[model samples]
Target: MSTKYKFHEPTAIYFISFAVVGWIDVFTRTVYRDLLLESLSYCRKEKGLNLHAWIIMSNHVHLIISSKEGYLLPNIMRDLKKYSSYRILKEIRENTMESRKEWMLYLFSKAGQQNSNNKNFQFWRQDNHPIELDPHLNMFEERIDYLHNNPVEAGLVANAADYLYSSAIDYEGGKGLIDIDVLI
Candidate 1:
């Protein structure tokens, strides 16, 4: 069985990125993205996880977050990845519009079985290198900006606010799709 590494700190600020196995565009539809938002919402309300910022791309997700209750960050990530993997795979199976269902499912299934905790397949890569946020304000701002501008840099949208799946709108004084907690 393969071993998974845990994030370094429990109450630390974390910059996490998880890619779809094979970097497949598993999140091409809004259903999977909505699943992610729902999962984050649940984590916030139930698990004391605080989401400072987040961006959901076609095949990956990036976030700056911290846990309020001192729960291990990696454990939260493991649950999030596991739940999203199951929900997204279910959606793909039932989705009529998704053309790459078979291939994507196969890839996820293969990856999951390689790991001891996974039964069928895995959707996300296991490593989530959490960077500790310095007390300096400028560094925090820089990281937040980078997260928001990622979609724009990838040419997915003209403006950061234009991306509905990111927290940029919230920080930029516009209503974003997901609710972001206070960063400080």
Candidate 2:
């Protein structure tokens, strides 16, 4: 991971993007997607991760996140990604319903082999591409809108609020998979 994508201002909200290696669509499975949701929820409640906005796509996740309990933003994001990677790999390995298990594992294993930082498998990529959000400049709203409309732009849904894995519903005043503080 390069220092350019790191979290520098601890209290500043940042829009970050993290994706699976090779841009694999590993999150097509509900199990893998739900694992990320669960981890995010846990981080919000227990780890003081303040999630302003979030969206989980097929293989990537976007977030408007910040520290609430004085935890460093980078550390919190690192923990979330680390825990989710472990659990998701475990789920993939153990899931009998997974048709692409062997291939996916092979790819992940190969990726891990290419990086000494990983012992066996690697899921999420190292770079977060954190961009500090400036609310005054309308950057914050711009990001939130882009995140909500991602699924729509991808043809996954006709409307942003209809995407089950996104915070668009929360922004629409409807309950979503996880609780969020709407920023847009």
For residues 98-153, write the lDDT of model 2, one tens digit per residue: 99999999999999999999999988888999999887899988999999899999
- Pull out the clashing pairs in model 2: none
Model 1 — which ten-residue stretch has the worst lDDT?
A: 1-10
Candidate 1, superposed: residue stretches over 4 Å from native: 1-6
The C-alpha stretches of model 2 lying farther than 4 A from their native spots are none
Q: Name the TM-score of candidate 1.
A: 0.90
**Which candidate has the highest TM-score of all?**
2
Task: Give a tens-digit lDDT track for model 1, residues 1-184.
Answer: 4333345567678777778878888677888999989998888777777899999998888888888775767667778877877787888889888888888888878888888977777888877756777756566788888888998999999999899999988888877877888574
TM-score of 2: 0.97
**Displacement of the residue 107 alpha carbon in candidate 2, Å:** 0.5
lDDT (Cα, 0-100) at 63 in candidate 2: 95
Candidate 2, residue 27: the lDDT equals: 82
**Pairs clashing in candidate 1?**
108-121, 109-121, 112-121, 112-122
